[model samples]
Target: MNALTLASASVKSRPLHATLCVLAAGAGIALLCAIFLLSGAVERSFIRNAQGIDVVVGAKGSPLQLVLSTVYAADVPNGNIEADQAKRIEHDPRVAKAIPLALGDNHNGYRIVGTTPDYLSLYDASFAQGKVFEKPFDAVAGALTHLKTGDSFLGAHGLAADSDDIHHYHAYTITGVLKPTGTVLDRLILTQVESVQQLHAHPDLGDPDAAEDLKISHEVTALLLKMKSPLSIMSMPRQLNKTSNMLAANPGYEMARFSRSMGFGKEVLTALGAGFVALSALMLLSALASSLAARRYDLGVLRVLGASPFTLSCTVIAEGMMLSLAGAVFGILAGHGMAYLVAVNIDSLQGLVLPQSFLHFGALDGALLGMGAVTGLVAGLVPAVSAARTDIAGILARGRA
Candidate 1:
């Protein structure tokens, strides 16, 4: 019979051992694949959303926090800056464009962002249904929010969906719905700056003076700025942080630092995956080596039946290869399957939505598959060689020992 047929029979005979090897290898590959896919998606999302914005200015606090809250909408803001102060920065000659963000309330779990129409242009957003908010209390829902035009909802006082502090004073009407841009915009509810101001202006509903005072002294959570020149990037943030009460953060720099901080966890996961793979390889080697004793008599019979030593060796090698290849294939599939699960459920895990492209298999996945195949070949080599140099005469004389 052929080497492949012999190998197939051998693997089937030791189903438990073969299955264990596949599971071990699959566990390792799953960790590595999930890390690669998740990290890549997060990096892409950060870069895409941070584009067009040069500096994020918020009340003095962590630069990273400012970037995370204003640019990614992933964190709570440090504090609020005066509207007059933000406007002063906006009119500066160094500033190309400045968009003020007033964040506080939410409808269900989605944040209601108060900003000008310029915010839509920053993301190159388009209408999936109607138009942008024109009057105070008019709103634009995101594609993922599932809120249709003409629907109205009361804003919760806090960022949490379950906040009991609801602003029942005014209800926001959805004037438009934004097409999916695969950015933070997809998860937000957009409205004019006055809408958020009105929602929060809890000015002792009995006092007109309190209401007027709030309108005149409005505060915004953060300012998203675009610099007039590349030099402004270095100058503006430094000048603002040192001279003003605001924290100025460069999105690119903060994100790079965030990535570096995440690298340690990724490295730890990679080490664990490598360890599992090594353990599987060693298991494969031990299994093959131990099985040789039982197979020696068979090898002797094959030798006497006109099979050359080279043919006998190939049969042993084929068994090792089949087991290894099966493990590799199983590992790759498990890895990607884990990644897909993580991607679909990312909202609950991290409060962020990853794009569908996160599940794509690329050249890196192919490289990983190749690495698995190579690992199998290496693990099986020594066992194959030992089988090749079997003492045929001794095995036949001793019979099936």
Candidate 2:
């Protein structure tokens, strides 16, 4: 029989050993694959949401926190900037557009964002049902939020999903349901800035005079700014930080720093994956070497039956490749499966909707497969050489003895 048939027979003979090799290799590949999938999805989501805004002007605090809290809605705000002062920045010559965000409440787990209709235009958001909020206490629910048009819900006082401090004085009526944009907007409840102001100001609306006084001292969580030009982007943040109480942060710069900080953990996981892969290669080598020793007599008989030395060597190499490739395929599936689970179940990764496909093949996947195949080939080479150089007469004599 041919080298391929011989290779198949040899692998079939050692089911347990083959399975061990496959599992070992698969573990390594799965880790690497999952890392790539999850990291890419997170990076894309962050970058996409961070777009349109050149600078985020918020109350003085951690710039990264400001970006995360304002842009991604993943954290609590730094503090609030005076609404009048933020409005002055809106009229700045360098500012093309400024959308004010008033935060500090939630319904269920979704954040309630108070902003103008221009906020919808910034994200190119479209309505799936009804229309945008035009009056105080009118709300527009995100596609993923539980509320639908005409529905009403009282806002919880805090950002936490389980906050019991509900604003019973006023309930927000859902005027619209936004189409899913796969961005932060999908998880936000949008309403007019006045709605948020009224909710917090008139917690006890029975005191109308007290509520009016509170209205005069309005504050916004942040200002999402689009600059007039490239020069404005570079100059505006420095100007704002120096001249005003608000801190202006570049989303791109903050995200880059965030990515760098995250790189350390990624490197650790990658190193572990590499170690497992190397161990798998060594295990494969040991298994092949042992198999070669046990099959020397059979190989000798094959040589006598007109199989060339080249064919015998090829058989051993082919067997190694088959086992490794099986592992690679299984690893890829397992890795993406893990990533999918993380995307759906993890609240932190809720902003991103990862590819739900079972086998999402990409350039990195091909590289992984190639790495596995190469590992197998390298592991098999020594045993293949030993098989090719086998002394047929000596092997037959030993077998007869």
Candidate 3:
């Protein structure tokens, strides 16, 4: 029989063992694929959130927290910086623009940001419908805001408030809708920074601020500053810290810091993945060795029937190659299926209005699949060697005994 035919018969002879090997190898491969997808997705999410802003200046707290709160709209602010301070920082020769954020209230879980029209341009926010918040209390809704024109968002109060509550308590009009930015900005309720300050300023329970000038509030949540040139950023934060109560952090700095922490975890997980692949290889070798010990007489019969040592080696190696192919293919499908499941579930959970054209796939996924195939092929080597060294006479005598 040809090497291919012999290999096929050998696999059929030990179907259970072959199937088990494929399963074991596939499990390791699936894990590798999952690691690649999840870690990559997280990194992508971070990048998406911090796309254009060069530096963030906020109240003295964690830089990452400031980014999360103001940029991503993830959490409430710890404190607010003065509006004049934000404007002074904006006037720096190195500073291109500063988009001040005044945050205090929430429309449901989403934050309400009071900032200038510059924020709309800075974040590239557009109108999905209607326009930006033009008049005070004439607030524009985020893509995620539960409120519409006639509909009012349940502010701090759970139900629609009466005129007394609407005027004094935490309530806002849903005048316009922001286009999806695909970032945390998409989830905010945006209005003039003065409007946000007023939400907190009025002494009476029902009276929000009647003041039109924003300088009166004297507080803002954060400032997003873009540098004229990135090189100009080196001493700018030091200069600003000397004059103001705010702290400045480069987005690139935090991105690298986070990447190192993430990379350390990835390295540990990768090593563990490699260890599992090694164990699978050893199991495959033991199985092949055991099968060879039992089949020595069969090998001798094949040799007597004119099968050359080279053909015997090819037959055994071909069986291993077949198993590797099967295992790798199954692993790839399982991995892809898992990635799809995560993407689907995340979409549902966040209710993020992602555009159809936003999906990004790259060479990294392909490289991971290739690594899985290599792992499987490496696992199959021991059995291939055992089959090549079968001794006919010795096996025949041992079988006879």
Model 1: per-residue Cα lDDT over 149-256, one tens digit each: 999998876578798666767899999999878788888999988888876676445543454436533888888999999999999999988998889999999999
Judge candidate 1 against the unseen true structure and give its global Cα lDDT, from 0 to 1: 0.81
**Per-residue lDDT of candidate 3, residues 78-134 (tens digit):** 567877777778887788877888776666556667887887776578887777778
Query: Largest TM-score belongs to which candidate?
Result: 2
How does each model score on lDDT? 0.81, 0.86, 0.66
Which pairs clash in the backbone of model 2? none
What's the best-to-worst order under lDDT?
2, 1, 3
What does candidate 1 score on TM?
0.88
Q: State the lDDT of candidate 2 residue by residue for 1-401, as single tens digits.
A: 67778898888888998899889878898888888888877888888888898999999999999999999998899989889898899999889999999998899979989999998887788999999999998999887786789998998876988987777778999999998776788899999888888777766545434554365339889999999999999899988889877899999999999999998998999999888888888898999999899898888998999888899889999988888888888888888898888877887776555345324678878888998898889888999999999999988877843
Clashes of each: 0, 0, 4
lDDT of 3 at 125: 80
Q: What is the lDDT of residue 282 in candidate 1?
A: 80
Model 3 quality (TM-score) = 0.78
Where's the lowest-lDDT run of ten residues in candidate 1? 348-357
- Best candidate, lDDT: 2
